[model samples]
Target: MTALTKNNPFAASVYVYDEEEYARMQMLVTEDVTAGVALKGDEVVSVFAHQDGAHPGVAQSMLRQATALGGRRLDCFDTVLPKLYADAGFVPVARLTWNDDYAPDGWNYETYRRYNNGRPDVVFMAYDPSAVGSLYERGAGKYVTDYDDGIAKTQAYQAASVGN
Candidate 1:
């Protein structure tokens, strides 16, 4: 594990997973990884970061390092992210959709509502290390889907009474 620090000059800590951990997360996603960065409890499995004015390639290197480290697959989401992840050999698998109208239990209390208009809908994609060489491989797809904190972005507009 690299000791990423502020002085290190990277916007985010690029992670490299060990063999054991990689295996565990892969099972959750139904994929295999020879290696890759496991971020936020395998929830946001990103090999890239686009925050803080950083170049996109930093994320690219992290993805390559993950495959090199024994990651057989790359798990990712979002249209923008998938395109970049695809450039590194990943393919789209499924889409995770969210509906702002149907508020979940914790929905009334998080930053999630801020993204409501956009609704935080996401697309998930991956690459199998074994299929890295093939230009065409049989891949399955699904529209299957499954969020938050609250800082009051549009709270004032929300009314407690139906009559209001």
Candidate 2:
């Protein structure tokens, strides 16, 4: 899993598993599984395809599995990730990207995205499923505010751009 996403700036942050879940998360995977979809609560933190000697669609397949497994939200940094998730019933909220003055963020070989600001973030896109209602419903769309959890917990917008 790390090998596929090593080029990502957030590679260090992708390790979102809590101690207990880390030991057992693999039990949830089956023989046919070939991709990695890291989750935090109901959100998917990371998705990586084992592109080394593997077939296409590994990442897409895992994303579908994530939704089926109850992922409610996720932040996608890959250029295509936004579109892929949009087609899967998710609604785009914030589209952030690093400024042109700075280099774009992405795997070394990837092309710079058209727009981005979500961190790791050369061009980040965050999505939430309509079923959960959107930030607009919660009155947060006005400012694209970070969640107000008030304590040691995950914030919606914070976790929405990157993993744990």
Candidate 3:
């Protein structure tokens, strides 16, 4: 395991774990069995950061660490903040949806289901860590703002549909 620290109080630590260990750690955070399955070899690296640590600095740090470790790709299951991943050069490749019965704590499954008219959506993203530096240099702030806007929109939509 490798740890990256930032000055931000919210983002105290970001850890990049070896494939086998990462896989084991993921088991406790999610029901997705394939979280790091594609990153089993040395070509890809798996990373973890607390939801509160989902800031640009942490993301950039992780990207750099992954690149330094000789990772060709980086894979992670970001339950929220797809746009942040998008900014880091990660693209959404898959979406996993779960019913209310299986939804994780703090996730408003009913709202998500209502937004999709009964389909909840969770995003899985991938990216080449090597390309992230250039991407970040281009317009990192824009991506973070866009992600925040998306969250705000979702919250507004859900709040509006509270009693419907």
Candidate 4:
């Protein structure tokens, strides 16, 4: 894992993975790597940084690189980092309960609500529509169906919610 620290005190570590290897790992039916079946392609699995503030530039760079490597999208589950993802050209598409199987028990609905000031469950965001072309065929018409509408709605909601 190479850390991206271009003059930033808070450096983000990036991890690149062979898509087949990742898919195989995901299909783990046992505790053995060899037993897993490989899929195909390449992917940027993670880019993480610890800081007191958000780093949009770093996040954007990571997203760009992931897309360039054929990643369909970037997935982040951090409940407190939606703005960061948004600034990095991601749009919210769905929300999930904090108590989802993936999250720890400590992150239950009550805890999530209290800590997030009554915010909904985790927000799932996808990269910008403009970035979709890099991962799909041109004129394929297979891009995000609600890209434009979602962006407009989200922006309006944000503008209205700011300073509240």
Candidate 5:
């Protein structure tokens, strides 16, 4: 039940590597804690999902969308959930001081970085479907169990389309 704001940035934007994914909408919002995704010039899709919503499916849904076109996309300015992202299908790209420069008006950068001695915490992750397998993929099931989303219907529709 938290409010979204620039200082409480809980969103992420990834740079898509594949041409196909780059053409698609580059943002996801599966929860209330997430902020609006800002599309930069090109190839860069930034989504802001606050850390508070990590336990829910906010980050997972966003990561799923980022890699939906085959996992050839990346750029996450994340300061949270490395293992969570790993289990969901993304690979760690780097761990470093947050390089995120985007902020909303009246946002204080100094206080934010002070959480880690004047450095914002962050880890970059990329989705590489070829390099890693998700937990659900290895679990016993024909499809990952996302009861809230109409995944079954979408799959059925695609399968039916292919048969035609």
Candidate 6:
């Protein structure tokens, strides 16, 4: 529900959304989701953008600032957005379903993803706290790995670091 008019190292502008609007989007989709805008000083550097399509650019921009701000993880339905997150070096963790009766398909998961709408799919992705820098510096090894596989790869890396 937010839009980013500008974004850069120095400044950015982002449209803000209230809880009511947020709820409406969820109600229409009837899925678990969250989104917002980013700002640096008084400028709107980037808006979280839409979850529907072509979000790689926006997700990367959002990831840049979100990581800088110590963002833990983002939760959203399995949609184009998660792919953008994965492309940004984040990994998919687990898929979950909502128990509400109004939820279609009983919020059941499809293909290890809870957001697959049959027409279009959605997925949730998680990013490592340290993968915020330039992709090359961090190594695209992790980025290329699927969300599920990344968990094991990261664990191995952690173990190796500890062994050293």
Give the top-scoring candidate (TM-score).
2
Q: Model 1, 86: alpha-carbon shift in Å?
A: 0.8
Compared with the true structure, what per-residue lDDT tens digits does model 5 show for residues 1-164?
Answer: 12354344332223223445435654445545443232333222454455565445565555555555333323333334445556655554444443345433343456445344334334444444544444321111122222222233334433453466
Best by lDDT: 2
TM-score of candidate 4 against the unseen true structure = 0.40
Residue by residue across 1-164, what tens digits does model 4's lDDT show? 12233443222212235555555532211132111111123222445543422543344555455545443333334344455555545555544443344443233354445434433344444555443323221121112333344334434434553435
Model 5: which ten-residue window has the lowest total lDDT?
136-145
| Root-mean-square deviation of every model | 15.5, 8.1, 14.8, 13.8, 13.0, 12.5
lDDT of each: 0.40, 0.45, 0.37, 0.39, 0.41, 0.39
Tens-digit lDDT string for candidate 6 (76-98): 34444455556555555443443
Clashes of each: 16, 7, 0, 0, 11, 14
Better of 2 and 6 by lDDT: 2
TM-scores vs. true structure, each candidate? 0.42, 0.51, 0.37, 0.40, 0.41, 0.39
Candidate 2 lDDT tens digits, 1-164: 54545554444334445557656543233244445676566666556554442557655566666767766566544355555565554554443333334433343323333323333232222344442322222111222223222111223544644553
Candidate 1: worst 10 consecutive residues by lDDT? Answer: 148-157
Expressed as tens digits, the lDDT of each residue in 1-164 for candidate 3 is: 22222332322112344556655432222232212212334333344444343253454455444434443333222333444555655544344443455443344334444335434344434454333533222122212223335344334433443435
Candidate 2 vs 5: which has more TM-score: 2
Error of 2 at 81 (Å): 1.4
CA deviation > 4 Å runs, candidate 4: 1-44, 52-57, 100-102, 105-114, 117-120, 131-164
